[model samples]
Target: MSAAYRFSVSIMPRDGILDPQGRAVEAALPELGAVNVHHVRVGRRVDLEVEAGTEAEAWTTVDRLAKELFANPLIESWQIESQPVTARMGPPK
Candidate 1:
């Protein structure tokens, strides 16, 4: 049986890139009784799962998704990685 593979893609702007939304969130953290957090920038995350015959193909698909779907393609760099999966046997009925 072909195993199931999972991929997680995290998209974020490079350092020194301006993020108004992230700054807003950081500023508001104090209002929630949370402090001591600094230099916080926000990004997006996309989770995808597929059963592929090969690991190479799984990586390729994720790259395409990062370029065409998740990232802006102009001002963002993305990181995509495959997670290891080990099957756990359930109780036999």
Candidate 2:
């Protein structure tokens, strides 16, 4: 039987790569009264649900998607965190 799983995918630019968004945020922070902050990097989180017979199967599915579609393998790296869903929640109103 397939069970519902929740996955949180985090995508970020690899270290040493130029992250313009991160640089922009870092520049703005000091002007906004924040100090001593450095090396700020911007990344994204994607929450998704999958149904599969086992945790491995669900991981494989999301892993493939993250590699092939979600992240740019050249400049970005990705991580996945998964957990079994005890109960499903309805969409936000």
Candidate 3:
């Protein structure tokens, strides 16, 4: 990840969330000729574009942000990764 500069932080639940949208979709599945589906739940992905000096710093910034804001430490788990920089995308110095 050393060569990486820009990072995308993805925050989502590790267990599950009871989603009404998912349930509605699941309920409709059987009528649409799809069956045997015992479980269905919905999860969302949050991508954060952040600025940092180094790859390590980028990871650290997002990690802290996730733990502090995006994720609820009580229920969900999250992960992050850095993307390859094609060209400078952050605010110009």
Candidate 4:
């Protein structure tokens, strides 16, 4: 049986880019009584459970997927983290 791995990807807009969502949240913070909230930026995280033969294979597959489907290199960047699954949770619900 193939081994299962968990991958987490973080994608964020590059610096100096306009972040409308972040701006909206930042503006609302003052009203919510949040103190000293500055330079707020918004980003997305994606998690995946994949089956692969080995850790190296899993990393390679995830990296390729990230480049092709996850991040827009022109305006965004991505970070990837991965680990082998020792126990089965029977997929995410």
For residues 8-81, could you state the per-residue lDDT of candidate 4 as single tens digits?
Answer: 88988889988898999998998989967899889888788777888789889988888889888788888998
Residue pairs whose backbone atoms clash in candidate 2: none
Clashes of 2: 0
lDDT of 3 by residue, 1-93 (tens): 233455555544455665576678798998988897856655555554556566677788788877898777676677676666654465654
Residue-by-residue lDDT tens digits, candidate 2, 70-89: 89999999999874464335
User: Where is model 1 more than 4 Å wrong at Cα?
Assistant: 1-3, 85-93
Judging by lDDT, tell me the better candidate of 1 and 4: 4
| Candidate number with the higher lDDT (1 or 2) | 2
Q: Per-residue lDDT for 13 in model 3?
A: 46
For each candidate in the order shown, give its overall lDDT on alpha carbons.
Answer: 0.79, 0.86, 0.65, 0.82
- What is the Å distance of residue 17 in model 2 from its true position? 0.7
Pitting candidate 3 against candidate 4, the one with the higher lDDT is 4
Model 3 C-alpha lDDT versus the unseen true structure: 0.65
Those runs of model 4 whose alpha carbons end farther than 4 Å from true positions after fitting are: 83-93
TM-score per candidate, chains pooled: 0.78, 0.88, 0.61, 0.85
